[model samples]
Target: MSRPRTLTDWQALAARLTPQLQGNAFINDDFVPAVSGETFECLNPATGERLAKVASCDGADAEIAVRHARAVFKRGGWSRMAPVERKGVLLRLADLMERHQDELALLDTLDMGKPITSALDDVAGAIGSMRHQAESIDKLYGEVAPTGEQVLGLVLREPLGVVASIVPWNFPLMMTAWKVAPALAAGNSVILKPSEKSPLSALRLAALAREAGLPSGVFQVLPGFGHTVGRALALSMDVECLAFTGSTTVGKQLMQYAGQSNLKRVFLECGGKSPNIVFADCADLDRVAESAAAAIFYNQGEVCIAGSRLLVENSIRDAFVAKVVAAAERMQPGDPLDPTSFMGAMVDSTQHERVMGYIRKGIDEGAVLRAGGEDVAGPGLFIRPVVFDGVTPEMVIGREEIFGPVLSVFGFETEEEALALANDSDFGLAAGLWSQDIGRIMRMTHRLESGQVFVNNWAGGDQSMPFGGVKQSGNGRDKSHHSLAEYTQLKSVWIALS
Candidate 1:
């Protein structure tokens, strides 16, 4: 079937998707309200409707959760379980998530205005992350270090007690899976603090873990703002490790909290202002143009590794910008429930205003608006695909992370200039470059500071690849054999042979 061309059609489809949604904190295998009896309204960004009034937990609630998690960790009901047995429990939780895919999908779509189909698809990634870690349990082996016959050395990986994860709203379920999946699979009791903006999915996931026969306090969710529950978790001495995916600023705070308290291991996957380079030698201009548009426009450009900076070789700059602008026009925001809508609403009004403010600032700084510089102007917080040509490095839009569908295009004459432009940022999360030159590709790949680099593509990678950043973009990797290691600590034991 062809995509819906009318706004009414999209609206009708979205209307059918809206259902009453609500959830409380999930702790110790049950749903419970905040000790303070406070709650916050979860609003649908697409239509400004109330999805739910979720419990707003404070420091006291955080303490209770940590105490429970610490008790379970000490008891070792899960931590001491055999590898295959732990794997089975995690696999069952994944199965339960798959069974309730649609229900989980709807909660995220209504809560954060993510496209319903995309939300549904993201659930698969989350499930896959769980299953992958679960399946790896028994296969993982400890190392026998080379030593003299008189001495035997064993290096074993052991679970860190009471892991706490704080995930962002943009990709709620997927990010949660990246953190919690490994923590739980590694036999650590987990306390998750999902972003207040979108907490419903994580709340549901906690229940599923309980249903899958996880011990009490083995998996839990605390849905509230970062200042309260999140700060409390970061500062808790009982939480031996902290894994987070959010802003660089907040990631730094968590590190500080860890220092001030227990000095827990902190792993962060934070913000990015990743660059996408288009060189003159690329054979496929049309394909590259389309992908470049999608790189920044996908998820309304809320993605942490979004290619907000488009660096094109000067030879193809004018023509390429025109092609990219044309492609972006077709991707204007629509009802998130419409599967055909590649773009959706901003997570909320604050984000919407922030994007618009960046657009105005860019124009003021002399960036020529080549395609779009406006909102869709309707019920939702939706923006049109914004493209700015003739952007320079000094411009605020060119330098800062917009976290919107605002594309800033810059032109470079040589590979050296492109590399310089790409490397000149506080972020090093991911970068993409387009070229047919093998030597250049090899050199650029070596020089690029990002954790991941794509050759001739944008955001192309598999589950096995590590994801994270360097510099202010934050530390530690997620979603690979490496992530499982981050959730654990290495112990070395030596035995003297008789």
Candidate 2:
């Protein structure tokens, strides 16, 4: 595909696209509007221009959606479907997603301000997840207990009803698929609440789900503000379970709401302050430096598992920092529609301002600014990647979760100190360790307090592996056979015979 050259080209492409909010909410086999007939504007983050008007669903709309989901679950339209049958639907949905990959990717790029290439990759990843979940659906078996005296006991896994999924703005479409595909595969009805910042692709996914033979009300999409729609979903008693991918503060608030309302099952993938450690025995310094730059600069460093903290061994700290700074400087921010653009704007002005504020804070806190610390002047909210050296564990920039392309480098004297520094954070989503020493890899893998540890590489994982975090980073796994369990509940059956 050819790249868009100017703002007019981008706008022309967006104008030709039909926004998903034009479609109605798929509730109980019908496309319906919000109860209040309210709607909100969906903006293109790159240009701060309104793209479409989406339904601004509120508490009453959430209640209606949840009720329909509950009714469908109780009526056995989805929850009672055979595991194989559900798997077939999920696989079909995956196929449908593949069919619409280009459109979906474009929607994501326009709505979420991600580069089109990366958005296309996200669509492909979503398809892969659907197929992955389908493959594991029928193979998931419950334990069988041995009993004597002509008595038999069987344990079975059942679906959790009325799951409310709230996805993040960064990877909106991909995260929706992450929750929806697995939850549906496990035979649960879902009420998805896409982030207000970027809800177009998610709404589009809902339409596709219905087209792919998923029963109506089995999947519903609500687009609105988090304070209104998201809060309602979290506190709804009918929402038996909640799955969220967002900031730690919102995750915590949802947990409290779940606890206060019905103590619903809450699964969260929250923020991260992941450490990327570089040891002196690293195999390739150039590769490590490039990886370090990409680790914090990819997707504008909006990734929840982004390697923001760099812990380098003192022997090669100076050289590594210099190389990483040089690498980061080579990446330029431009329009998302430009295929050659390595980086794009932040999701919106708010996020853009937040990231810029963090950069200023880093400077004020006495961390040495290595490279690319200022916000770029453009119509879009673009901030250049920033790297800081002489960072300590206690500094605000070192401890806090800044979901942007900002890297903090700290020198470590020994492996013990490196491990300690890596683990010394409230968030433990993911960490990357660069070293050729087998013993060091083993030690760091065991010592690093993260859900995923990447050795040499960064953010390397498949749908077959579980993805999540420990401590304040939130609980519950996202991918693999483990995610299926999160959507299912086990029931024990006992039989007695004379």
Candidate 3:
């Protein structure tokens, strides 16, 4: 699909791509609402218009979905399918996603205010993730270990029955694929609860799964608020495992719910206030500045691993700051439907207000508002890229995860001070270091508290690399073969020989 240039073209493209649905949850391969017949409006953040009414699913809906998932698992429908058969279905699903890439992108853009380019990237990522998991499960084998001479020990990986995947609004489609593809590949019945802020993509993905020949009830999407349906799913005794990607606050609550219920295994990829460190010895200041802008401004800075904090070496701080400001100025927030727009609106008015509040807090804390600290002049929930200079670690903006296009700059004199500033944060999901010195790169790689560190680049990796965080940023890895471990259980058996 070619890029839609004008607003008229964009509107026409959206109409062609998106399906007009009567708000309902995708359960057991059918669209239906909550037993109570409750519904909620899904608003277009870009225009603040009601896009559609989605099912306001609650505990009752969760129960029905769980029972359906359990029944399907017990019937040996998807769980007992041959590995090759499962792989074929997933590959077909990926193919379907590729064929309808434009539609998927439009659904995500309309639903969550993500820029069309980024939404398209999410679609590509979802396709790749599904294909990666599907390919991996087919080739992987259980291990046999030698015990004493007369016996053999074998370790087998088994699916954890029914899994509940609750994903965040940001990167809706990608996060869903990150959790669901691996769980489904491991032969588990999956019940997905996508964030109410962005439920369209998940619901559409469920439709594609069924069209790709997945067994009925094998995969389901429940659209509703997090407090009700999300809590119900978390507290369900039948849900064997729960995989989530969201805020640290909600992630902690889900963990407690898991312990209180069936003690279901929980895997989370939560919040981050990641630091991007740039040393004076780094020669590529231009590229560094470009990446720095992209690091914090992409997706309107709603990324969990966004480089919100910048720790720069004092010697080159001024030059780097100027370049970064220029880069940020070039990337303005605009209409999400336009393919040329680098930044888009916030997920909603609530998030927009929250981000503006953070900006005000930064000013109150006495940091210099260097650039783009206010909401854009026009309508919609659009906020310009904000950069704060002379920031102290004690300030709320420096320490907190704003989850917006806000960047805080801190200057340090030495490597020791830089490392200290980077590691002082309560969250450590991801960090970035830019330096030409191999020794500094090697040292920082070992010293940084983050789970993943980018040497020169910022915020990018493929499905092959594992992604997660440490400390308050949550636990467990996503994307790679390691993610399979989250959805599977290990069984060890000893066989006696003659």
Candidate 4:
């Protein structure tokens, strides 16, 4: 069957909807422009075409957003609502999200160059995350301390007022839902700053939230460069909490800003140099090879937790590398709108060039290019998936977070050496171990210094488990009851008997 031609149709659909800047920032229960009249253009990464004009909010606008959020929180618009009522609103929001899945998916694909199929899945995941939080809210309970005296002591969780959540470009819509749903479920207003590279879905989400009856000022979308709007959010005193998912460098800067400003709670899920360790004892070599390729190439490898470093036991290193290289060769970079296309363009030209440069550096540094080591010339930012074998731990390709469809394979003879190689990097975001021995799995899981350790698989976490990283990968967690603490403050109530 022929592939359907739908890119132009999707673009037209996006053109029909009013752009983000056209609608004012949702603040104080109304839509209004920023204190500044500045604006920025959203670029379609696939074609470098102008997608839409978005608000270029400055510090003044951020101040207005935070103040409005504070007002709404104090007024009890969302915070005072019963848990069931809030759940109903969030559930309705999820339903509304489902209703507009096609539009949201199309916008996401056009703006971000993600596969249309993946974009649709992201919409579903976003809805699922929202509903998950809604259901989890009622089960959230405070703690009680046992006391010998007649006095009673109780601990309660309260909203942390306004939270500044900065989401990344790769999974813009789903990440925004991951941050906002839990914050709203915990009774905190949120000011979301999506990556300027991909703000279309976030703006659409803001509109949907309003349509679903979210109180004004309870949710706001600020679309601007990281230097202006993101800086404002990181340093805002009224934003009592800050949650970020991006690079460790920026995460550190935001941490410093938070320390200098309000000393607010900060949650970060930063970069990764995750290891996908393969052992000779593995059950299925073909499945392992396929999963490894998918692990590094999925979403064009923009994943923060991507298993970029492949540690293969020396016994089967040659064969495994051959299999992985063959699998990667089968995957091709094509127009994201093409349903059969397995890989899309990089988020932008700069990222495209960066990935290509890394490939060149790998060659220059003596790593063997097993497959795909060049850029595909095109109007859009596209690079073929690259794989490098015989990579040492000190090599740039093995140590750095490429954030592209590139894989570095390292060979180790002993299990201890595999663990050493995996834990060599400063990042500890996510790692996977492929071994048949249960004792080896347990030993590796305990030794690997990563936030998430997957055994015989890769990237299998739901909204229920805590997701975050250690070391330079950043701190705090997302997705689960633990996330509520990031958006909430604990208070202790003490009563004395006379």
List per-prediction Cα lDDT, in the order shown.
0.89, 0.87, 0.92, 0.86
| Runs of candidate 3 exceeding 4 Å displacement | 1-7, 17-19
Q: List model 1 lDDT by residue over 1-498, tens digit each.
A: 343335555455446544544468988988999999999989999988887889999899999999999899899999989989999999999999988886777678778988877788789889999998898878899999999999999999999999999999999999999999889889899999999999999988887888899999899899999999999999998899999998889988999999999899998988899999889999889899999999999999999999999999998888999999999988888888777888989999999999999999999999999988888777899999999999999899999999999999999998999999999999999999899999999999999999989898888865688888888898888888888999888999999997
TM-score, cand. 1 vs. native: 0.96
Error of 3 at 180 (Å): 0.5
lDDT of 2 by residue, 142-247 (tens): 8878889688889989998989999998888889888988898988999888888788888788778888898878999988889998999999988889999999
What TM-score would you give candidate 4 relative to the actual structure?
Answer: 0.96
Residue runs of model 4 more than 4 Å from their true location after superposition: 1-24
RMSD of 4: 2.3
| Tens digit of per-residue lDDT, candidate 4, span 266-362 | 9898999999999999989999999999999989998999989999988898999899988998787888776677888899877888888899899
Per-prediction TM-score: 0.96, 0.96, 0.98, 0.96
Q: Candidate 3 overall Cα lDDT vs. reference?
A: 0.92
Lowest lDDT sum, 10 consecutive residues, model 4, at 17-26
Query: Mind giving the per-residue lDDT tens digits that candidate 3 earns over 127-226?
Result: 9999999999988899988678899899999899999999999999999999999999999999999999999888888888999999989999999988
Q: List the residue pairs that clash in candidate 3.
A: none
Which is better, 1 or 2, measured by lDDT? 1
State the weakest 10-residue window (summed lDDT) of model 3. Answer: 14-23
